[model samples]
Target: SDYSQEPPRHPALLVNSKEPFNAEPHRSALVTSYVTPVEFFYKRNHGPVPIVDDIDKFSVSITGLIENPKELCMKDILRLPKYAVTATLQCAGNRRTAMSKTRKVKGVGWDIAAIGNAIWGGAKLADVLELIGIPKFSYISPCGGKHVEFVSIDKCKEENGGPYKASIPLSQATNPEADILLAYEMNGETLNRDHGYPLRVIVPGVIGARSVKWLDSINIIAKECQGLFTQKDYKMFPPSVNWDNIDWSTRRPQMDFPIQSAICSLDDVNNLKPGKITIKGYAVSGGGRGIERVEVSIDGGKTWVEASKYQKAGVPYISDDESCDKWAWVLFEAEADVPESTEIVAKAVDIAGNVQPENVEVIWNLRGILNTSWHRVHVQIGR
Candidate 1:
């Protein structure tokens, strides 16, 4: 069956772009469930999904600035020791919608759904790099002798653009804590075509775009991959800056995500019996930082209470491990006696002591990059 043609099953709260690639979901959805099912997980793609007919013939080429070049087939990659990790994949522009509210920005109008968490299974990237003879001492190259580039097997001809490619700094590529992988499976099954079938790079704690899908090649270089996806886009700018008065050269690409949390319950309108109401949601942080605490407020931040940890309805308990570094979001809940008429407000805080901004207007950027703010909902109390 062609999955691409099928409509999304769950309700989508946001839609960033259309056609070959799309991004969706709002911050409110994050707390709806602890384990975001693959069917409901947000989908983010750069180009048309590439079809790989034969797994046997599929091979990833490793070249550039290395003492040895090697081509490893699917069989060869699977033969190497396998590893599993539970991690989250978030788009650099996951909150772009919030940013767009301030000013116009290029690219998709992604909402909070650009991020999701799952168990990723694959070969360790460090092991793969060692097999290809990438010396341990080689410092990752960036713009000039500084970055490592990852190329995808998929290709497309845009109106005036050449091909699409994504890159990352050498530090992110080589960091042991980054948990980079040549992932072949997600949530215990073969990767779906939309999520990059056969093989894709999974860089935990980094932006999803850099985790190039349909991964085909890796070039260890002294300069950043000069692809449009990396250098020309995904950069963050101040709210004061607009398209007409911006300096593209001075901007930096978004790498690590910031601490964020959101309320997943109490939609714009809900009918409550007027006895008790429960608030639920999830909170996460980038750069391998775990969520320390999540606080909920029912009265618009006027007063706060620590949400009961891991007490949400649908979240599964995950044990801590070296490979699974507390990466999954923390599901939280708060139950309170409610009056006949009132509005419900909720927010979250991460391990770094970074609370979700009080108002979207405060952190609203022209591009809607980081929209971490208090989530509010109104409910009518029933007689």
Candidate 2:
């Protein structure tokens, strides 16, 4: 692995791993603005970032179980109708660090920052599929293709040095309402090497792992992708299940993230002058669900207060509304008077009434994915 070829990263990022680089911004950085800047976006990579210097020559091969297999180059894709989508991409292991404290778990040790919201610009994947002879909203092809596999140019040890790949159901891939993008730009600029540069698949509202970057090809398969990251990794397991008894096929890959919220204005432990305090952070749900309410608790979890939520500044957030970006996150804030030392906690509820669990132990898994437990931070007020 040639680490030298990797692109430069933001100096403020807290790097978790150097090779196959993975880093995240501080929790405070996440809530500074509604749309996360590209520089502050978390980087989750499985291998060295592949360099594609020749955009004109680069192309994505669309093949497998298709009537008309076509290799669409940059120009060919750019001709399709363009759409901009503001979506949040969260790693399946976003809160692995918190999960690890309950019990030992595998994978990267990440805090609450393994997530980011960005405005992605690109051609609609449904439009691209239409060019390859698949009509919009088709669930299966005439040749028995049920899944759309996205293969990347980057290689990882997890796949035994094979190119990383993942897949989505054919129904989702062909549904224009899904807002799936073969994204070419991030945050209004051409994607930097850290992100998918020439091309990538943006499977909005799903776990970030399925959005394969630096895309090399698209495959119409009879079944879901059998890649290591798909079949062996990213699946949740019971707390009682260990490597000995773990069955990979028993559980399906995690898709939509659960309801989640966190306190970014304060640290895990903080000392502050006793006075009025403004608590702010991000709240988001998966599968196009909107955050209904964010509750803040200053006296541990015994009592709670509903925090105000919004997506754009000065505009109240309403789920599934035309104005609200259904795939994006909502930022919440609440003011409190802290006269004595107390533990502060925050939990989110989506529009569907799904609330984050109260305890991490109960939802503990071997892989440490989807730890949507209440986020807690302790405060020591005054001397």
Tens digit per residue, CA lDDT, model 1, 1-383: 12355334345535455555575665565666666667667887655667888888899988887878889998878987888877788877665655665556565776556778788889877778777865434464444555667788765544133445677766666654567888999889998877778898887777777788788888876666777767667777766777788776887777777777666666656788878778876667777777766777666568878776562354433334343346566677888887766667666656567667777777666656666667666777888
Candidate 1: misplaced stretches above 4 Å? Answer: 1-17, 23-33, 102-106, 136-145, 156-162, 311-324, 340-343
Estimate the TM-score of every prediction.
Answer: 0.86, 0.98
**Whose lDDT is greatest here?**
2
Candidate 1 structure lDDT: 0.70
Per-candidate count of clashing residue pairs (backbone under 3 Å): 13, 0
Each candidate: RMSD: 3.7, 1.7
